[model samples]
Target: MFRCARAFSTSPLFKYAAMTCRQYSFQVFRDVPPLRQMRRQLLLDRKTVGFVPTMGALHEGHLSLIRQAATENTDVFVSIFVNPTQFGVNEDLSSYPRTWDSDVAKLEELNDEFARLGGDTGRISAILAPTPKVMYPTLPPSSEVDGDGSFVTITPLSRKLEGASRPVFFRGVATVCMKLFNIVQADRAYFGQKDVQQTVVIKRLVQDFYINTDIVIGDTVREHDGLAMSSRNVYLGARRRAVGLVIYDALKAAENAYNSGKLARSEILDAANGVASRVLSEQQALSPSERALYEVDYISLADPDTLDEVETIDPSKGAIISGAVKMVPLEESKPGEDCGLGDGKVPVRLIDNLIFKPRP
Candidate 1:
């Protein structure tokens, strides 16, 4: 027979012991705590916070900013307040999508993921769920009077583009954003380049008001076919969607002309118009039902910073090409025919921009 110690070591018990030891060498992970718990911990830990303000119908475009914030900042806060003051009387504020449940779900999902990755979940907070009365105190009855305004007015680089169309828009945006910055106390803020004008105005506001938030701008996200990602794109029907490509095509034509030694502003505008005209003409050939329906508002190229119309591309200064098109509805009668709608209006406004930076 074998010695007792040798027999014990060589037996299945010894093999099982070895296996258990190997398994023990590897680490076991417990389930991560929920974001709410992690956030509380982070807040207690004293982390710096960043913010992104949006009218939520959150998309990849918005998520990209959050991801950037996650990488660079200790905390991230997103506010989703659609301020009524920004919208014109005839604008789509009434029909603008507001999916609060889904928006909160997305924010919570992002917060939890960040938390699991050891990021400060408390940093990625949202302030959209509060009731109107609680968030904005009731104004005195006289505050609505012609000269009894209680809200502070922000005079920014308005009087152009969306500002020209919606005069009171930027004032409202600036005021609401000021409130958001005060509430969040963010060290940095993220904005997409799609709204170049709005970006300029916000920068001015921060500077003039002495707000201490660092602004970061993300690239404008676009569809595979080059149409800029926008919430209003949902309103486009089949034909209108096809016609929508004209905007992108026009922008590209203008860019190509600028790059290929064509410096004349008129020539560039002509190039854009050429592309738009071709598409419009083709659509006009189709039956009213088959044709895409839209009204071109304006096409312009301007200095990205000053927002003034630029005749020549300055290699040092960037330019922004922007325009708006109104979409007509399907099931409505022909262009001149009234569908009982007063102005024959199906305002599916499409706004897009292309930003050009000089080569190094």
Candidate 2:
């Protein structure tokens, strides 16, 4: 039996702050020993663990997943490690948001709500937030492809859609997630649908590896204007932020065209491209300081499962119409600074998807 270092209060009203405000009783572990010890204790006590892995910078989307995990399992473990492996060399690993203190506060706020509503039997038992150094003491040097240590790769699936853009993305994602699953060994894992391809890859990872974890996908949460909630959304300036909605707008356009008996794949893609063109025209009309913020990456219909581009939509099998748009700040328009493709313009790639099922 693994002896845990600490024990949570069994009282129904667990408190951390004063009576003026409710507080959570969840513990945060930065190393593996105490985390594993606690996990062993929870499993020995017949608890069903639900895991929500994240890269910190908590938002409403992340909160929704945590709430679901806490509600569904005997014990919930939320890991907040920003896996370095998942980020490409040109990606925003360094610029990525790292609001750890605020993230804890958000989780604690949710815990307080759960407690207030008589949350019992299931609570956010602990947080597994190890640093990259601690999590990967022998982590290889970062590279666009083929990092230092061994990695988990899902062929074909890992090489499509988002994979085509960021080659090493799934390799890093699969590796870190595999390590996390091995550590938590949770009964259920929750993921948001915003990264549809990522969810697909993880589901495949769980199946191919024979890991006994149920992958639960939460719906994609969006802003009032339809921009998908994402940590990188912060990088979008005010003008670019508004323009980011083009991704969702384009996906909706494609879905509408498909539902209206436009089954030809080229026609649907053209509809989405038209929306992108309209967005570009609008951006071009803005002041130079606020113009040139939108860049369309790719828009297409794909097999919902394989993520492969399709020639025609099969009414029986729904397809995912997804588009990616890269938005940059206006002020970063310099000769060698941010204008060129993949330059350090601090571009934010916004992606959105819609499931198109032909109506009978």
Candidate 3:
């Protein structure tokens, strides 16, 4: 029987005095050899593996995936690598949330929950928390366009929507994920719907690459107020956090509007844009200075599959209405001043989406 190390119980992060949860320890590997060896052992034992890839900073949204994996597969491997490749030059790679201690605690919490439910114990058997150096020992030379270092790319799909905004984002995502898929060799891989396009891209990647794994997408988890949960959400200041709700509200409105028999693409876009505008207007009215803090990047209606703009929603096929907004915290500036966001303002970009399907 696997036993947790006594040190974990006394560790600051792993202390469970709050509740009488079962104590257990899963192997954590920092290098590739041990991880691969474990996978080999699992394969030799004829056990199926479910994989959950994450950037740490665990939340309920992430927990749902782990729970689903534990319930379905004989073994679950959760990777806690904060992949640096995915972040853009101007992105929050440095400032991105990294609560390693809290993350491990959440993993422990899930294992205990699984035990409490009489589900298979020790389902969460491995955690691969490799560092950038471990994942990629050598950096690409600067002269190369993308890089002399190896990378994976899914054309067309990688160049659309989210990719359009952050050009190299999907390439990095595809490369790292493909590496994970190769290393884990999981029977099933799980993803969340919060990143709708990313899920689509990964699904396509699996199909095209002929990887022997099933891709499962969990529903997007939301806060009580309907705001989609995200790791970047920690960057949102109080007012900006409240203001960010507009994305969800806007998507809900768009879905409702599509259900109301208005199929025109322009009309649907206008509906979501209107809701977002109203939310922004109200916030601005409450405090005019907040106006500079909220900016709608784009509101688009597109075919869910191809992600191309659709003139009409084929209720049978379904469609997606999505948008991104730039939310910033208050920066001290006079009413007539430029707001000067570079100095004190904390800006974070948020994205949300909704799917509309007509009733059959």
Task: Please give, for residues 294-353, the per-residue lDDT of candidate 3 as tens digits.
Answer: 788877788887888899878788888888898865654444644322332657888988
TM-score of 2: 0.87
User: Top lDDT: which candidate number?
Assistant: 2
Least well predicted 10-residue stretch by lDDT in candidate 3: 5-14
Q: Which stretches in model 2 have alpha-carbon errors above 4 Å?
A: 1-24, 119-121, 139-141, 332-345, 357-360
- For candidate 2, write residues 1-360 as lDDT tens digits: 222223332222222222222234777676787788878988898989999999988898988888888778978889887787778888877777777568878877887788787745377878887656666777553645855687899999998888889898899899889989999999999999988889989999999999989999898889998888998877665556776788898888888888788888989998889989998898787777656567787886898888889998888887888877777656544354333323435778888788786456
Evaluate model 1: give its lDDT. Answer: 0.66
Give model 3's TM-score versus the native structure. Answer: 0.87
Off-target runs (Cα >4 Å) in candidate 3 are 1-24, 120-122, 140-145, 286-292, 332-344
RMSD of 1: 15.6
Q: What tens-digit string does per-residue lDDT give for candidate 1 at 1-360?
A: 111111112232112122122121111111112323434565677766667787877777787788787777776767665566667666777666565446656766776677778733333643333323323556521212132333445454677887777776776677678877766567788988877788888888888889988888888888888887776665564456678878888989988887886766798889888888888888878887567766777888888877889888776775888887776665444555323222333457777778777754
Candidate 2, pairs of clashing residues: none
lDDT, model 2, position 97: 73
TM-scores of the candidates are: 0.78, 0.87, 0.87
**lDDT for each candidate structure:** 0.66, 0.79, 0.77
TM-score of 1: 0.78
Q: Local error of candidate 1 at 153, Å? A: 4.8
